[model samples]
Target: MNTIAEHIADFLKEYPPFDNLTFQELSDIATNIRVINLEKHAVLFQINDLLHDSFYVVASGVINLTTIADAEETIINKCHEGDIFGLRPFFAKNNYMMTAKAREESIIYAIPIAVFRPFVANNSDVLNFLLENFAINSRHAKDNVNSNGKLISDTAFYVDQQSEMQYIQSLAYNNSPLTTESNSIIKDVAILMTESMVDNIVICEKNNPIGIVTNADLSSKIATGRYPITETIDKIMSSPVVTVIENVSLAEAQLLMLKNNVTHLCVTKDGTSKSAVKGIISEHDLIVAQASNPGVLIKEIKRSQLPKDLKQIRDRLSDLIQNSIQKNIPISHISNIASEINLAIIKRAVELSILDLGSPPARFAWLSIGSQGRKEQLLLTDQDSILIFEDVAPEKYREVKDYFLRLAKRTTSILEKVGYEYCPNGHMGSNMLWCKSLTDWTKQYNSWMNTPGENSNDLSSIFFDYEIVFGEPKIEEVIENVIFKNAVNNTLFFDFLGNDALKRNSPLSFFKKFIVEEEGPHKTKFDIKTRALMPLIDAARLLILNANIKGIKNTYLRFKQLAITDSKNAEIYLSCAEAFLTLSKFRTVEGLKNDDSGQYINLREMSKTDKEKLKNALTPMKDLEELIKSKFQLTQFS
Candidate 1:
């Protein structure tokens, strides 16, 4: 009885309809429910059947809501364990549009609809969940296969309704972004052109761009000395630069560029110069920002004028990682490049944070920790960073700490908006403890190392991977020197780190097929991070740390560095690096297709040929792990 109740509770916890029910309510419902077993191809419901007193849920096996489309049967949503169906259509006074069939052997529960309706009226959570599904399922003709027979493919709503995302910048009409102020001398304007490496600029007055000046203006007028270098910009500059409003489409912007024979245009608040210059768009800036490829995308990032612009730039960053992984680019190189971009973005964020606070009271450093520190971050993973400052007097300590704290908070916010999802547990530099002085960081490292205690594993996991990201580098180096002083040759430190590394076992099992998941949000899959990625990362970090190697955080780089130094074990280290790279590529391509973290992989999705490639890649990782176990005498520990 208890087992039955617990199963009901567990099922309730995973799903929306039952989530709000208390244990007693669930137990009472379960006690009253009637369970039935149905064989394959059994009919659960028929068309035009009056609504039953209860809702039917699949306890196990597949129940499909399928409809015919284009003379073919289409299954909309497959219902399995704990999946509740038949509630929405009937509750809304709709006749059963189709039939529900058992696609496989099934166990089902029928819960009285009367009991559920009262709860729906009272519970906002349940009502919202029901409404969201009702919206999707009802609008989708595909749901007809489940109950009302209808075709859904032609009318799947979300297929085109794009919501807000990191990318997708809408183009607007505007003035040429490049400009020369009317008060500036023509000579200074030419120098500005040369410095900016641009061929044209819009000459403007009172923040409203008037007319354009280009190489043509310089070639015909300045080089010929029609206007002397000392002459004011208005003497030779074209007056009244073309301007347009913010809702201009991409096509209009292009046509204007072509019609005026101008390479640059300034975007203004209004369609005319009566308003201030809002932005400038260049033909080259548009052409190069393909919004797809890495080479072009990086150019776009460099040209971005807003956080919104940077959002698009960051969106392409994932594509860059995905492509690099697909092409089997070294994860080490991939991580390094990604880390550089992330560092640049964070630096920009920190700069904004400073300005937002009026100004920084004193100088400080923003340190990149964990994956970013090692620079092996192939994905936009968790951001673990810390703040370090130059030591101030005792009386000013509180004042300085508050300033840095506020700055870290602002920087972290921009980072979140740019699509590195906020760390679930707040392991970021925004936390007060993480934003500290150089002395405090040194002390933190010292405490974790020498006085390793019960909670050492968690602390070591974070601090051991620290490296400087933004701000003063010398201060970080000072902290590094202090950490190594307490850490190297420390057996307890090595053991703790080693144990944590070993926790992520190799992906293989006794059967030799890669062990996959049974179930969760991503069930029946293998987590790349835990199995393939972690094993290599942990081994590299452990082996390098054991050798007293420092400064490098990226796994492949660490392995390569260690390989050069320890010629004896270099071959194995190199193999591990390659293995890591290969796995990263696999996960990357998989992620690009799905737009996810590129962690879990569906074994079924792999082609037979791809499976062979994966098997080959796994061999090096397996051997490396075995070698580590043997070298460290980890067998006994296991």
Candidate 2:
């Protein structure tokens, strides 16, 4: 009886739903608990299984909530000590959407729903929390996108859930468009239609639509010589023009188009020819606007000829990221897609730069530094990179160097034109020192490692995320190998890197207020980049470097891998990864709000609750830095 009460209390204390019950109440409930023991792979609940009077809580071991993911049996969530299971049946029609199986020999507490219902009915907060969490947990959006993989939905929920996605397919158009004078000649009227790319040109007097000349009018009257080409367009135009007002919904627009058998709709101020036409919305525009495929955004970026268009694409990308985040995308998939978008943007920038240069003297590879190099950059920040060219003899070095330098300068200028600010520290490829051959880069890295100094450390940081944006893939691999080989077992270097990484604590105080920067560009503001992101970023880099790991350059993934390897620090590292996601979200939002990098936060404007949460988040980051310092023996270096 004592063990039963203690076990129930133990499990209740760890989870929210049961936490509402007091010890005496829980003890009274626990006495009637039915403890069930199961062997490995034994099913606790199956699909369509009738409601069991009792819900489950893990008491002695682990349970796997297995579902179909990517076409195979997969465990989506693991339930451990004090974790509840089989509750989907209690609140959700008493049928299991997923099967719960014991991963090993385990004992589970069966808390009868009959006794729990009364407590839940009386406690709104308890009930509300369960309801919300249950939806979030059970739907678990990452695996639900496609319905075919085992434990994953492969049926394309991203495509399937259009209504849920809230996409508005229709373009708002105004009727009663500004039209040419009724007596305007064919050439003059034709120019206006051509410039506007309108299918039809409206003829008006006093800016009031009186008639419309479409493609048919030009073909019949102008081409057939039924009327002279130089004659007034009023002879060919159709009179009694139909008009509509702006703010029509997609359905209404479609209906109007169908009813009038017209391909274009003119939106006006008052839905009459007497009112000025605001704009035209074509059927093609409406269809394209409805496109849900993410690829369209990339295509738009590629086709953009101006900086403002690319900027709009970037803004769209931000919206896309927020959508993915809100839709509960797995961070991995989100980063992967985002990385592709960044590459597309950079590639287009490179293409534009190449166009500007007219022609290149030699083959070269453009490298992206920092987060971008790692295939992990999810946000735009300072452009850190260099240019690597094929080798040139000493006599010809200046010729080759000048050519690449000019190219690099043009490339960065175009990227800056597209909104990636140049590196404040002059780490961009345009720097003469940065435009080097692969051999020079390899040799340079060897020198940095052998003769390590503060400058070398700074160089190492820049080189760590060296991703080749253009040029030969082989040379990029060669440069990477050189850096990796030198970095491995370079304990002194790791110590230095570790010390640098842990130098800043998370940005908030124990009291949860932003720690104001003492001086420099952000003297009055909170420097979130240095104090919050950089510390975590540096720690992740050291851990990955120390492990001799490659490819996973994103900080979150680095910490995730570290957690898998370092059992002792697994929880701390996992929490760090979560905090990073939250912090990244916060920073991105802050940047979007203020039109800066979002690194320099304005603390005074933040809500008290937010300040408290921000402060709370920094502790884990501080602890993470401490762990890195102790693990790497960075204090010895300090």
Candidate 3:
């Protein structure tokens, strides 16, 4: 009973855009498509050829896209099975800009614009896919054309109108939300969730929503041996639930979720949490609303069992980042999503490493230091990690330490396989110096706090930002408490840290020109990390340490917290937070473009607008450095 059109429709249903379409709709589209076979080296289209009435999707084999330059063919990209090409010309209604030829014997399904245009006009997901493809292809063509090389305005290639319109539309949510009381036992709650066939439940107090618990919370908090089934639900529930009004647009809801880093949004009578719960919108709801997207990337990361699979997910993550940036989404939102994905990848790596090495010999915690600990690692960078195991007796110490060292090596290898490079300075957990017992780590922190020197300062800056990536969190809490207690009373250490914070001079010169490296391989390039971000980072660490604040590792978050605690200097700290976000975004975009760490930036390559933005972002760095100098009384010491 399966006709060729029906067969093709079934295959199309497996991929996106088409996957979002109904079976009937896909069958209709399949009827309009023409299946064409080509031998190797067969030309599908050529440069400057008149626009075809149809666009092609490779059903099998490969298609090579190349441009003719200087009378030579320069390959731009290769389109494999299920990959769509020739869509750009149709969207632009222009002649072919590149030559498409069969790289191998190929079969492509050519769908006419008359048939596809209707679907694109009706389905926002389809339109978004096409627009994204157009943006990517156009950017590639521009880069290839300018390969002889000059910087083109990146702003010109970003497509926002269609995506923005889609985002502003009303979102669909479950009007009748399942709920439970805060006093309910975890076992009862689980039974209720099973009976209702729900993955999440809102905990209410007198018909007012107060918290939420998802299957993830149950698995991580209960099944992990951290809590008992008879424990009260409130113990594991996320408090002060994020909420939205019934009439909120999808974009607004998404922004709220991203801002709060939550997956569930309780739809209330009003927008505030005090209002009665009316409905619920979860990340799964958004996934169904917007086809395979960043949320899907998270799902994929969690599902992946192999390191290579995470690499593929990460590659898709880059595209997601590009699409988000081009759509002009807030940089913080993008960073939050990226950080979640990064953490998920690391978590999975640790899980797999545990399987490889068996269970830990003792309770230990894994710490991600540096940018990752700050939750701002947007690009693939060298890994900086440490391992801390529970203290043991003298005879047991060697056995426990050796077991953790092997585990750390396996974990780091898995992460490296997943694209996180090994630390260049031997800062990873595999090193004996970083992998230590709890007592040893506490002693180490005390030593650094008491003896403030160049080496200690360097270690402080790197180690202080640490966040537990995996394992027993209480171990990290104990270590952090020790560090905080020591740091608060160490005036001499503050002076040393303040001097280190002031090491990077202001990024701007007297005439307001950027003070860039004038010599060496990085001539005229700005080191945004050192000259701009680090001063703010160091200042935040020192000021927060002085305030005896612990567990706030992120620079921007530390500033935000500092603003709330230190009202007089709130304005300066808030400005620094904004500047840090701007600089982080700039670095991420630059890294994506050049395929390298976005540390040093060539001002000559940046557009005028970007240069101006960078200059403005740097203004807060000097003010922050001055605040640090005055607070710690460091002017006389350095």
Candidate 4:
């Protein structure tokens, strides 16, 4: 007695987009669906086929999506029951880039795009799901595309619905916002605004927003005697309205607003004022879309008075990282956000310390070294920082040194309380050896560069990536100039750095098995940081320093720039960057899972897919190591 549509609706309801819809809506869509049954090896669609009016959902059995290159078919993904495919029509107007065939006897439900697009446009969750998956798939595909033109589709294998990466997620702004001509009377605009219930209106000239007038503008300029109510709207409007493109994320919008010191952002056709006005985003919109955005956390960090208050905010960062990883965000973007939050916490800690110690005797800068310096410290880690105060007179040296040391102690102590552990090697601002005047810091670098030794090389690895987190940047600039001068054409120092880099054994063995720790607490566990990540980091630093590249500190970024500077070995450098990002993501995920630093991984516990992914990520390390060996002439060192 069951209707076919009802039976189809019941099956479709178990999946997403459909699951998010009401049963009635699902049933309605089912009525328009065309159910097709196929025998094993039967093709549903082929590459270069014209766009279909409907996309598919596997109702039963398996569908293998593939692409052909060099006359060989490569399986891109396997879509099982409840899986969706052929979604290219939803996003693009092009013909199919892939072919979908039945791996076994299969039943597919083809849902009309006309019926599905409304749900996508109206529902945020459904739209986010599709966009997130498609974007992730496209990104990974792009990254893995080979010279032979075969596109690898690893990310398309799974759909993750765990957490919304709202910070990076495209904002949903008011597209049909109220607008008024700049020549319009202020009184007329006010009445039109009162009826429309909008707090602000874009003042336009030929559909392009020239300015914006908000409630504040009306109150400050018009409400006051400065501008009469009868005056033109342009008389009170804020000129050259801050604008963002349609795809601007909540975090970006917040930063743009903060940077420009405006409460609203005008969304334009081309991200400029010259383009057509598309929409507007107010601070209220950002607050509503808030899901652990860096801007919000940064505001909290600056406002926090006590270290404990900052700790509470710091603790929330792990969750942000977890969600971002779940959402498969690029590691670079995730690290940048984490770094901003980390810097803000450090800056705030310094502010609180300054408050406690009153005013400083001399100008000083707080330098973050190591992972924090490179802006890649995603998880809570050691505080590796140095304090460089301005050089003072010989008579005032003790007094100035004493003041900065006290300041360093106070700031580092606060950071420790906020969860960044004290550097075990004493590479901290609080350490008297690290906390020095600008002159001493310069002399220290010169000594290390002139005489390359074990201790100096170890220190070089950590300190060379130094970036100023707080205080006078001029102090850091002086130190940077000194380093670049000493670093240029310093073959001996680069060889030492290279020798340090090649110290770690390859992550894989002769049989391509993971070379894990053989003994101790981490026995049988793979050291991801030491074996996989450090080699890339070390190689990048050595090459960047050798190439005399300045300012780029992040390992992947260093490699990317090196690709440009050393085009002869560009492929190897690019692959190293890709591998580093993949490995970092694995480590971050493992760390988040185990609630630790994620340096070591228990290979036995990993899934087959995860192990394969990790293995694929490690493939470039061999090439990177060889490049270092030849470039640094490590054969002579050996």
Candidate 5:
């Protein structure tokens, strides 16, 4: 009943660039499109050929873009369905730089550049998309220049220009530095440092810095009996202070420090000690200015006293994650650094919360469940936690529980203020169900594992991956021992969990295309968390529990351990580990871009390279599901 142009319009509207255009615009563009079908190994455009009047969008099959040099073809990139190619030459008005050929029997829709030019000029989003594509492809072409016979992965070629830009920006320094008279005695300077709460002070003469004294100087000189406390401060100070202009870049300041073999540099209006001292730049200051450095964030977290202070630090951490992803750093490495910072924040929150609620009545362990528990949390999501206290007397049970509930409430509130949203399902430690005594927690785990059902399986999945964020280490050990003892021998419970693991089917359809949401608010989008990540997580958890493994809570680590223990399926387990890392990296990048939970991914927004990478990562998931079905004997239950 519909014309071919209308059908093409329907499909085009589902993807970006066209998706950014209005319905009428899309219909007009579709009306002018010429659909061409090519056989396998057919050429679409050749190198050095005059540019065609139109560019192409692959509607089906794959196309390989390559260059012929030294009489051989070098593949630069592969374009799959919904991907655009040969667009750059149209814009540059130059001959085709590379040849585009159909890798398989394919159908492509060629749209005249003149018809698309209006949208590019009018729609900012469309223009940006085209520009980004051009920049990325240009970088790829440059990288392939020296690859004589080999292909370089895109991940290996991305350079971190952001860090270089930061290095060139003006460095920030401490303006109001502590100072003392040059003739002051060493003992007097020590007292001044104590009163001002400063580790270092500048020696001033007529409002100009002549030398500097630091805690290290005091320790190595005065405290070691090399100099007397009664000696003048200048006698112990490092004279002839190294100075740099206040406007110098961070890289320049660092170079000055290294060249002089000093840890501190005085900043002056001019680049010499003759000018007035405006500020002081220390090695520590340089470290802090590089906000993306995890070490700097950790130190800041430790020094923070208020919730607002931690909120600022968390905001900076988001920048760090973005920079790390841009540099193509390994996701596992990034997650570990982020997890450490997250733990530090929670620990600081607990310390401050105790001050608010008076001291705790008894010792209790704080557990971080869900993503934070597995050490995979990159962006802040909902807070899933539990509170376990040491057993109390029957008469004192109510009093103890009441005290911990107030403590949990204060801590969760502080964390929420610091950017971790409270769990939508009320699974936080503040909830009575999750806040319990040691004996009670043990009983909870036993009951959940022994009884196999929908509710128990749901609870088990959330609670089982927990790691202690605060309190006595032994409390965590005891709880984990209880879980392994109960779960290792529970056959019925394994079946329940295995069935739950397979609840979300593989993300690919019968034709090996993505099985995106068909309708509702998430139409044409994929739930990466539930479809790709959770299934892998659930599968790993079940496998680790069956093996009676303890102390490894992270999903990737669990798979690695499974591979080590069961060599029969080691290959599949290892592949799943790699797949999990890649998928997590993708989700984090998307989340950072949209400022959301990174749960729903719009397939239309992704580049062809990213889509292909995602599909490759998800391929192992189907194999993993098949393995679970055969190993757990889940065939009978479902």
Candidate 6:
């Protein structure tokens, strides 16, 4: 049999703070621990009780941490196995603010605060872990105080889960950056860059960054003999350096780098070239900041050469989605991150296909349509896309078309091998009907717009949401211009789309119960996609199209933009955005649990709170549908 101290040490080793300690350190602390057993309903500490000499770790059973409010007891949180409670003594001298009572027969370990204080004071990791836990739980308690048993808000969960990610936090950059004078010789500046083990050096004049020179500049300018080695650094430096303020976030920094197509950014006091340089942020710094899974996965996807390699990275994305949900990271954030990785995978897949098929016969743009295009695809679903190539000579059309068809076939095949299912309805670029020359695509859109009906409306809805995943931007731009010009004043098409938006009535029945499939494969299961999500998506698309809003594809974003442009119905638009996020998150969670599309939900198994949330989310639909009907004059059109 293990000694009491050994068993205590083993259990404590499984949890944080204690988990960071060595076994000997744990045993040393465990030796002085007190084990207490209590029956159900026993109170370990009540509100306003004097601070205990010890904090606690639940060994077995459950502890209810609660407070009395509004003349009634409100449970703030439940502390189960390996959960720590009664931590007030370590941080505060005041009496306990909440009461800890045994929810059932329980065993607890009370580690004397005197022994734990040493670890808190000495170990940064242990200190940070406790502080994070304490802050997260305290925030939860505050949110629960007004929640009335509702789950914690997404914002709160995001703070708790991503508190460590520091994506939005001010970047921790090198305060002392390497700099050189414009008068310095190229060879000397190059020597300085090499000696400092840095790739880039900023050229400063009067302590202000005027330009930057990187190793690429040296290789191209000096090594290539385009400029003499003795030339002034100014001759080779890239002028008008990209600048950002000290408080820029990791996300913002990465965006600036990508947008400017540069690897380094000059951090200045006032975010302009005239300001004094405070530091420099390189691509390396951003990579180190995101040294977590998402960054690593994106890097792997870009470097991956084979379909199987891409498939493994895609599988890791599922785990990332699951963990993000559990951490309560908002679905919008999760979807954005996942969508970026997915786009990279597709882009890389296209590159690999080109390696096999050689160069394209004509300039082309690969368009991702539907959910992936909307940047809302969380679950693995069918790839819906179209290929638009530049207009070719009529005589050479057959040869060019054949080449692109072969390319699309190879690319889609690789995508399938990477886990994206092929569209069953032949909506992919591999289909000749969907892939066409830019001029032909423009003609097709005009055909659909002039002839409004169920078929044309369905095709327009899918085709209008296309976002270019790769290739020539001009091809996609020409089609977009054609769409806006023809679609802006197209009343008949709007009416048809408005009617289609109302196709699924409401997700709820006359009695306000969820409408479920009565028969078929998903018998008695709610179709959230058709009912809850589609209504909002369709409404946003119709309204935005009518308003001539360009370049906004995501449904929630379309609604957000509508809120700005159509202020009269701003309240309804904002509510729809929130509702869409909540419903999308709900569906994503259900999908993750069952490993399938989160479309049809088994309402019978839903918890009371989830049902209430769903019902509340759907409430906005009535207002949105009314807004669409009023805006489109659907009654007269019908």
- The digit string of per-residue lDDT tens for model 6 on 332-393 reads 76777778778989999888988898999999999999898899899988898899999999
- Ranking according to TM-score, highest score first: 4, 5, 6, 2, 3, 1
lDDT of 3 by residue, 1-638 (tens): 24999989988787666877899988999998899999999999887888788777778887777776578777766676776777644433347777789989999999887776667656767755554434342334433342211111111122222223223234567888889998899999999899988889999998899999999999999999899999999999998898877766545565456445678999999877888999999877765655444445666777888989998888766766665666566676566666767888888888888888788888999999888898878888889989999988889999899998888888788888878899989898999999999999998888888787745734657788888888999998998889888886699888887887888777899999988997998888898888887888888888898899887888888999999999999999999999988998888788888877788888888999999999998887767777777787777634
lDDT of 5 by residue, 275-326 (tens): 8888989888877666544455677788888999999988877876776677
Predicted structure 6, TM vs. truth: 0.57
lDDT of 2 at 246: 61
- How high is each candidate's TM-score? 0.53, 0.57, 0.56, 0.59, 0.58, 0.57
Worst 10 residues of 6 by lDDT: 148-157
- Clashes per candidate (backbone, < 3 Å): 24, 31, 0, 0, 0, 0
Lowest-sum lDDT 10-residue window in model 2: 148-157
Residue lDDT tens for model 2, 575-631: 888877767766766876766778888887889887766766677976776687677
Q: What would you estimate as the lDDT of candidate 4?
A: 0.81
Once fitted onto the true fold, the runs of candidate 6 whose alpha carbons sit more than 4 angstroms away are 1-292, 454-460, 636-638
In model 4, state the lDDT of residue 585.
92
The candidate maximizing TM-score is: 4
Clashing pairs in 6: none
Candidate 3 regions off by >4 Å?
1-291, 454-460
Off by over 4 Å in 5: 1-292, 454-460, 636-638
